[model samples]
Target: MSQHAVLDNNTHRDLRVRIEPNADLGDAIMSCVTVPAEFRQVQAHFPILFHKNQANGAFNAIALFGFENGENLFLEGGKWDALYRPLALSIQPFLIGRSADGDGPGQVHIDMDHARTGDANGVRLFDEGGQATPYLEDIASRLGLLDAGYRASEAFFAALRQHELLEPLTLEIELDDGAKRSLVGFHIIDEERLRALDAATLGELHEAGYLMPIFMALASLSHITELVARKNRREAHG
Candidate 1:
């Protein structure tokens, strides 16, 4: 397969497959930022609805995973303060979309003040007029974005598997703006000992810098994958 095609497939497969515990932060972000049943439950409580842009024609949806207190935060919101508070911890956002899906319809603003009671378990959604609607459950049930996010992730992993770069490699690229950016994915095929890389190569990336987050993600994924494999083996033998 062509390099582009291979990479695309590999990305998709990677999405479907959970990240190994050894995966670095990037992988962890990808794996954990998925839309699952638990996340759906959370979304059911706090639903933020918005429209997406049109250029791409595919499914449109995004799933955000963060921390608010002890509970996990997942919702759709434009304003950072509304969805994330200063005290919140480990806040990360994931966007899911496609060309076919087109931009979302009208936007709906939810009022957190009235929606949030003393309960910290989940979020509550409000209507346009800032009124509580009994149909919250019904609205949550029909959220298509959550499912769309899962599908998008699967597609990304599949693309990666096709590339045969699943092992581990560092990606270094030079942007059009004359800036260099280095990102370490789950695979790291080559290692630079700082001294080996020429001054020119190093200089390009000096401003953009290398992202260590991807390494952390890969480590986390590797660990999770091992745990899952062990559990499966035990079950089979038992």
Candidate 2:
């Protein structure tokens, strides 16, 4: 349970949070989330996919880390397996929340009850003069980047939808129990359609700086092989 409060030095002095590097801190059921401007780095490890919120009909780009629900294969030995951890997962116990004043925009808030937060064993939040510590400053910077990245992605998402490059992906996998599972309804970049685009359209994407990230998203699809292999290995071990 999260009891988020606007982070303050006076109220949180002497507080220390033991950042868990190895543990899987992301949502257990839906391990995937939007990567925004971090797609270039995210694509190197996770498969980038286009997802639509059925309830709100919002389209966003996401980095897929596992095949089935609640199964993040990258999690092992009480830690994450990959070298590049997504920003969404790294900035734990902290998030962009609604401003208390309700005046301008969202502000940063921390889950006061998070397992990482305590009186000891983690980075300090503030100094004696009630100023942010170095650790806190770095966290603030990361959060800023994450917020800006998501905002910037809106335009890129629009370009993708306009060009009709997003297409649904379906997968057939046999689990360790000899049960065949069909992963469906998720979307991916349609490479064929992307390739078939005209020079003018290509120029537009290039001018808009959407070309590279699109290629990165396409490249990340290869990571699906790693997911399949992990599943096969799990079944064989069993």
Best by lDDT: 2
Q: Where is model 1 more than 4 Å wrong at Cα?
A: 1-123, 127-196, 221-225, 233-238
lDDT per residue (tens digit) for residues 1-238 in model 1? 1111111222222221111111121222211232322233323222211112345522221222221122222211322223322111121111223334555542222221221212334333334455434444333333344444444444433432333223433435443345443433224212333335567745543333221221222233333333333334433554
> Mind giving the per-residue lDDT tens digits that candidate 2 earns over 74-146?
7766667788777777777788876556456767789888767773768888888888888888888878788
* TM-scores for every candidate against the unseen true structure: 0.25, 0.87
The segments of candidate 2 whose C-alpha lies over 4 angstroms from its true place after superposition are 22-30, 98-106, 175-179, 236-238
- Model 1 reaches what TM-score against the true structure? 0.25
Worst 10 residues of 1 by lDDT: 86-95
Point to the candidate with the largest TM-score.
2
Local distance difference test, candidate 2: 0.78
